[model samples]
Target: MSDLTRKTAAELSELMASKQASSVEVTQAHLDRIAAVDGSVKAFLHVDTEGALAQAAAVDAKRAAGEELGPLAGVPLALKDVLTQEGVPTTAGSKILEGWKPPYDSTVVKRLKAAGIVILGKTNMDEFAMGSSTENSAYGTTHNPWDLTRIPGGSGGGSSAAISAWEAPLAIGTDTGGSIRQPGAFTGTVGVKPTYGGTSRYGLIALASSLDTPGPCARTTLDAALLHEAIAGWDPMDSTSINQDVPPVVAAARNGDVSGLRIGVVKELGGDGYQPGVEARFHEAVELLTKLGAEVVEVSCPHFEYALPAYYLILPSEASSNLAKFDAMRYGLRVGDDGTNSAETVTGLSREAGFGDEVKRRIILGTHALSSGYYDAYYGQAQKVRTLIARDFIKAYEQVDVLVSPATPTTAFAIGDRINDPIAMYKNDLCTIPSNLAGNAAASFPCGLADEDGLPVGFHVMAPVMRDDLLYTVGAALESALAEKWGGVLMSKAPELVVNR
Candidate 1:
């Protein structure tokens, strides 16, 4: 592997700025890394070799002309397949949209391009972003770089896996539940879910309209923060986009000091279901924060326990409505159109052929939830629970600057372990669901590895809505302190993947 492939996005930018390396060199290095190891890691759904190189060349030319550039200019990034990039195939990991190239750029994509970042290609995801494991992807499961036998947490697993495996230093992920943070925890990378509506959702393949949040993934907190700034801001195209200044996340990440900051350890997120190693690492991270001069206290959000069920109900209901656009009559995967078949039959045939098991399951559950007799009982009740969860966050934030928890209950489970058990699969997001329910900013940073499995455990931090800078503050502090003990970033501890050629 080339040394360029291992450098952080920030480091790569500095190299380009100093004229020590051209953008094409950095972009090609990552492309080569993907070629060498992606066969084993399977992080990318598509590799836009030609497009990425061309973008890199343009950046190099602009730099040679002495034009101003952003901090992340010329850095290569992996985009989740759920986002549309004009003329690039976006599958959302389902056959329904297989080979569909969008005609326009998503707000996120437009921002990335404007920043002069090279688009590496689309990464795999759970079909329609439905499940917690990439096993639901019609393409294939994204294996954890730590252990190929285990899963890279999903529906944005490919994005996380790409960063973990060093195929790309940065990637984009959407968190509807725990998709970004859970996968970050499992892969020992940094993942951030900006405050809901904080990042524009325009052109993001919607899983749940209200819950879906596009965010950044990287091997380091500052790198994640840089990407977060590049993609986050007010967008006139999205009705839900927050009309406010993007938080000073990059500054907070650079600050990395938690001295005098009040940190809360959530009373509801630990014990019982949490693995001993996960809990051990989590508590140690808290102690480290306290030792670094932060005030630590245990806070309660009782409604968090109801977040999982409430999230399931709300997500599917929204997904059912959002996914209705794929009817075989408009675009993407058509079937039973032999000229004699009725429109309804063609739509049914296309849907049955296009959607995978998980997508179909959620659509049915959502349809039922929205049905006349059940809407008031199921969906309405879930909305009430969501409100309670939000209120719990509001109440807790009144006492604490931020809340902390184990990002997930355990390290990455072996692939297929919970695939057959839907309820078990759903429980993976237990600690993460409440944040999505509340529409607040949350992130996961690698604290330490679990002793039993020797896999990474994430230290999760939650800040109030729009206080995304605080999430970076806590993450950077933890990352710096932990790096001193480990002698390097936690990703350096991951087992190296065998190169293909």
Candidate 2:
């Protein structure tokens, strides 16, 4: 493997700017890596080799002409299939939209292009971003780079897996109840869920409109921050987009000082359910923060206990409404349209054939929750719980600059471990749901490997709404401290994969 594939996005940018390496060389190296390992890792659903090389050539040409380029010019990225990229096939990991090439670019895609980032291709995801493990993907589950028998986190598992496998230095992922952060935890990479509206959601295939947040995924905190600034900011196209300046996240990640910072450990997020190795790593992270001069305190977010139940109800209700657009009328897969079938029957059959079991389950649950007679008892009450969860965050933020916890309750389990057990799969989002419910900024960075399984553990940090920079500030501090103690980045310890290069 070429060393270029191992460099951070920031490092790659520096080399490109200094003419030490051409954009085509960098892009080709990653494409080569994808060709070598992706068959085993199964990270990407599509690979845009031609488009990526063309973009790289354009950047090289512009550099030759002395035209100033964007800060991340010539960097390659792995885009989650949920985001629309003009003319690229976007399935969102479901057969429903299989081979469906989008006609236009999503706002996030446009931004990345304008910044001179070369998109390698679309990464895999859970069908419509629906499940805790990538097992729910209609295509197939993404296997962890650390252990091929285990799962990579879902629904954005493909994105995180790509980064961890070094097929792409940066990737895009959406967090709707832990999709981004959990996968990052399992893969020993960095994932951030910016404040819900901090990044535009116009082109993301909606799972739950209010909770879907597209953000950056990378191997290092600073790399994630660089990608975050590139893709974040107000967008008039998205009604929910925050109309304000993005926080100085890139600067904060570079600063990386946690002295005197007040950090709170959420009391409700961890306990008996958590794996012992995960808890051991979490406590070590807290102690490391304290040693770095952060004032670590245990803060109770009492209402957080209700986050899971509320998220399930609210997510399904919104998903029920959002997914209605895929009725086989306008575009995408259409089934049972023989001359004998009615339009309604075709629509029903198309959905039945296209959607996987988990998607069907959520739609049914959502439909019932939003039904006329049961709406008040289920969905309405869930909304009330959502408000309480937000209030819990608001109160906790008042006392501490940021809150910390284990990103997931446990390390990556076997691929088939919880597929048949929906409740067990749902539990994966327990720690990450509160942040999404509150629409605040949150991130997961590698802490250390669990002693029992030697799987990577993630330390999660969350900040107040629009104060996303705080996530990087704390994450960078902890990441640097942890790396020093471990003798290198946590990813250095990932077990090697045997692939024919």
lDDT of every model, 2 decimals: 0.94, 0.94
In angstroms, the error of model 2 at 192 is 0.2
Q: Which ten residues in a row have the lowest lDDT in candidate 2?
A: 492-501
At residue 431, candidate 1 shows an lDDT of 90
- Which residue pairs of candidate 2 clash? none
Expressed as tens digits, the lDDT of each residue in 339-410 for candidate 1 is 999999999999999999888989999999999999999999999999999999999989999999999999
Query: Which regions in candidate 1 have their CA more than 4 angstroms from the true location?
Result: none
Candidate 2 residues lying further than 4 Å off, grouped into runs, are none
Per-residue lDDT of model 2, residues 71-111, tens digit only: 89999999999999999999999888988988999999999
Q: Would you list the clashing residue pairs of candidate 1?
A: none
Error of 2 at 49 (Å): 0.7
